[model samples]
Target: MPVGLRDRIAAELTAVIHGGDLKLERYAGPPGDPGLFGIAPGDPVWRVHGQATGMLTGGFAALMLQSLHPLAMAGVDDHSDFRADPVGRLNGTVRFITTTTFGSSAAAREVIDLVRLIHTRVHGTTPDGRPYRADDPDLLTWVHTAEVRSFLAGHQSYAPRALRLTPAECDAYYRQVAPVAEALGAREVPRSSREVERYLARMRPGLRVTPAASDALLFLRRFGRTRQERLVVRPLMNASVGLLPDWARAELGIHRPAAVRSCWDLPVATAVGRTLEWGLGPSRIQAAARGRLAGARQG
Candidate 1:
């Protein structure tokens, strides 16, 4: 296939995934500028995070898992219009990740500052009347870990061979992304897969399925801004459910046993994820990172 055709197809699919407002031509950052973490093109995080499959599936799984935390959910519930404007939230998230991962340091810091400012005002009570704040260091840690964990898992499960990270690379990815989590006020953030696992285990007791959490999952499962998007939700939701930890699966009432996972869930998730990755072609931010990398090597 022609590169133009492939890129066009990928961009269209990406727009649907991100709510149709994403235009690759508008994705901007200075060429040759390393972002806040100074992650290079060869970094494990660059390989893992650049995969569309892992990002979408992992992000979907993380949202479901994170909602189990009542305090975290409360902040989202009170402040976000996810129900009314799902794409806006998704676009914001995409911008944050892309900027941090591949934009200039100034761009990354700008997003971080914006998010921190937003966090200051995102405080509320859960339905059971417990207080919650987005910027609480502990809450920030949970959210950050969940996102990174899910992204890694999604990459492991969904990315094509060229994009997949080795075990060492995976750990490196965890380490690379940790600084941003800390900058976001996440304390004692996990920097490896094992540490992330241990943190989740320790956090289990505090996690529970509330009406708020359940409703959020349902909304996500059914989320789509367009007829085209609605068509793609089922397989993606299936993939998201499959990526979740067992504890999360139980909490969300998504039961796919080992046999089912191996036989059905994994394959479907892999296929859907890869399809998106292929359809979306190369991300503009990642292309910029590659350009920077090439220039540095030549210099």
Candidate 2:
């Protein structure tokens, strides 16, 4: 069977994370001196790794929604601006994923889920050698919460709309979400509105991240925007014959004459005609033929 989109994305992301391209040595300024102040200077490899991880994770979260709730996918896609801002997009996506499907526990449990998976892959052992459970402090829950909260606080300053609810309303929302949290074996769901605020506050201090990591994250924020633009343009150019749509093309003003020539001159019609002659279904065969033709030309 063909690989599902989620698995393919997960595999690619895992490879990127483990590729060793993102690692950076801690800079030593002078003997016993603190390194570069404010923003730590970062290596290009770190930047590339951070950017790739952000893109993959952001795309993965969006795809997860697409898998779980088709209607939510449209909401997510329509909010492309939110998606373009990596921090905002990620927080928004996580909130939507949890709240829509799981409610209040959504935020807490999803954080644990992502963290546990990442840790298990990276460390090669869970607490019991049976895979990390959601409650494990070092391996499972807290680490995930710290990472998610760090990402959110680092990138976003705006409060979620969910916070706009009145105390009573918020309490009701929490109550509604409590069952999901309970099912996940959360030690304690924030019982009241005040407890929720306090829970977040307590988690806040632990979310402090190193300057080098922050710089790495900032690089990812910028890289995601650039990739989004590239994705939009590549498809448009592939489908059309004439001048490309402005939205679909880069603004760098560097023209790729070779690519333009290849795209226009390629025997797309001949390839399609041959595939149709093979008695295969038109749509499926055309797609397969196009892929093969593209591969052959590249080879």
Candidate 3:
């Protein structure tokens, strides 16, 4: 039986987003698997990661923010072929995050270990002549903090009210997701909203946009397979920029006016969010994980 037009359209989008690796079946049973952190519909991680509009924009925002750290950017610029293979790079990241979030425990651990092993070989020196390694605890912490902070910001700013996290839930999301970073060998990870802010402030003196990062940002901003896709992505990119802290935005050279943000970016973000919901119809990945957990409970 056909799944219907909406589902087929969604499948295509998922294929694009996951880069043709929609292992939806992997999110299914064998029961008793909660992946890394157990999936509850109302859980902070689930709520934040479930919203497509938020995740997409958040990801772009995070890359922009992450690139500010010279050492972190150094490892990425030297080792990643993101220049020639941006989609491949994106697919790898999506695989790790979605799998760890929704795949079975064994699957999640497997991906985590693979990433750790890959990190072992990723080392280089920044332009300023400081040696950097992907596995460095401090670098890992910076990457993780910047990413989740942007994610939370995106969810708060763009997701529908029903999907948005409360202030308390936002705090919970950070605390809950911190362990994932720690498992990747990050130490002293921030586990609360305030902790993350303080951590970012403490790290500010070392952050800046290098030339390589500038090039990368330009590439991300302009990426899309078709004219239609580019049109859709443009507002989301601007909305992502809108979510950045004033200081971070100033550093990144983003200065969208408040009036434009309210009149244009936010409205477009909302429309896109609804369009995504119409197409994707709640997350199939989250549904599969829920089914997997329900089976365990039934058993």
Query: Which candidate, 2 or 3, has the higher lDDT?
Result: 3
CA lDDT, every model vs. true structure: 0.80, 0.31, 0.84
How far residue 140's Cα lies from its native spot in candidate 2, in Å, is: 5.9
Model 2: residues >4 Å from true position, as ranges? 1-164, 204-207, 223-299
Model 1: residues with Cα > 4 Å off, grouped in runs: 1-8, 17-31, 297-299
Model 1, 136: alpha-carbon shift in Å? 0.7
Residue 184 shift from truth in candidate 1, angstroms: 1.2
TM-score of every candidate? 0.90, 0.29, 0.94
TM-score of decoy 3: 0.94
Instruction: Report the error of model 3 at residue 234, Å.
Output: 1.1
For each of the candidates, the C-alpha root-mean-square deviation to the true structure, in angstroms, is: 2.5, 22.7, 2.2
Could you give candidate 3's per-residue lDDT for residues 188-288 as a string of tens digits? 99888989999999999989999988888888889877787788788888888887888888888877898898799888887876776788776778888
